[model samples]
Structures are given as C-alpha cells and as structure tokens.
Target: MSTRLQSTNIPSIHVVIPGIESLKTSLESISHDTKFEHEKDMMFFRQRGKILIDAMFDYHPIHLMALFLNPRTRKMKQCTNSQRQSCLEYIKQEMIMFDAFDSDTQS
Candidate 1:
C-alpha cells in the first residue's frame, strides 16, 4: 500500500482514501475475532489500527473530496452515504462560490 501510494504517476490523494479504508477494514476483521494466538501481535495491531484510524479522521474530508473529483473514484463506494452527501455538498458550495466570483468579474 505504501509503495503504491508513493508511485509518481498515480494521484496520491486518490490512492490514500481507498487504501486507508481497505486497511481499516482489514484491521477491523482482525480485531473482530475474540481469540488471539499472540498477545503481543494483537496489541501491536490494535495500537497501529487505532493510530491509523484516528489520523484518518483528521484528513477524511479532504481525502473524500479528492476521491469525488477523480473519474475512477467518483462513486466512492467505500465511503458512507452521509460522507458522500457531505462531499457533494462541499463541491456544490465551491461551485456556487466560483460562479459568484465569475459573475462579479463579468460585472
């Protein structure tokens, strides 16, 4: 995932949102099982997952916007309905602002 994220040709924002989502899903699956073979391994994954999930919260809106703008990722199926709606609202707001600016300049 990190290697793919670092690729020069790919848009990093496009990869980041989905990549983190995939990772979060995997982590949730791992944590779902009650039994753990190794306590240390469980602890390590829990801490790392917590950190990653928390970090994601801080940047989720920006990542969602990037995903929405990308042709391939525009559907953003991985995101929740509320999140998708939020992104749409933000884009609409930006478009309104741009239109206002354009009209003012024309005048």
Candidate 2:
C-alpha cells in the first residue's frame, strides 16, 4: 500500500482511504478471540485501534479531502452527506486561496 501511494502515476488517494479500511479489517482479524490468545492481549489491541485512528486523523484533515471527491468513495453507503459537504466546503476555500496565490505570483 505504501508503494502504491509513492507511485507517481497512480491515484494515490484512492489507495490511501481503502488502505485504512483494510487496516480496520486487519485489526478486527487480529483481535478476534482465539483459543491461544489471552484476554489482556485482546484489550491491548482494542486500545491500539483507538490510538491509531486518532493519529490518522491528526496527521492532516485536508489530505483526506481527496477521498470525498472520488465517486467511488463519495457514493459509498458508509459516507454521509454531511461529511462530504463539510470536507467539500473546506476544500473549496483552500482552492480559492491557492488560486489567489497563483494569480499574485503570475502578476
């Protein structure tokens, strides 16, 4: 997944959102009850999941805007209308700022 993200030709954001989803799936798989596992180990993994998710969001909120634009993720049943709108609004404001900077540079 990291390799795909580093590729110059690929849609990097597409790989990113799903990569997290895959992580969540993997976390579930790893933390599930098994005959060989102890209860304390399961508790530790559960705690890790929260920390991981918090860190992911703390990295940057805007980089995640790319996820809202893509149709595949936009129309997902899991994606709410409000989430899309909020991210879109912030992204639009950012684009406007970039355009203003570009105009200043050109002039």
lDDT of each: 0.80, 0.66
| Per-prediction TM-score | 0.74, 0.55
Who wins the lDDT comparison? 1
What alpha-carbon RMSD in Å does predicted model 1 have with respect to the real structure? 3.2
Model 2 scores worst on lDDT over the 10 consecutive residues at 54-63
CA error at residue 17 for candidate 1, angstroms: 1.1
Those runs of model 1 whose alpha carbons end farther than 4 Å from true positions after fitting are 31-36, 39-44
Residue 10, model 1: Cα distance from true site in angstroms = 4.0
Residues 1-107 of candidate 1: C-alpha lDDT, one tens digit per residue: 78879989866887787887787777655555657678668778777986878675654577889988989889998888988999889889889999999999999
lDDT (tens digit, per residue) of candidate 2 on 1-107: 77877899867765565676566666656534556657677768866995787476532345457676677665533334765666778888999999999999999
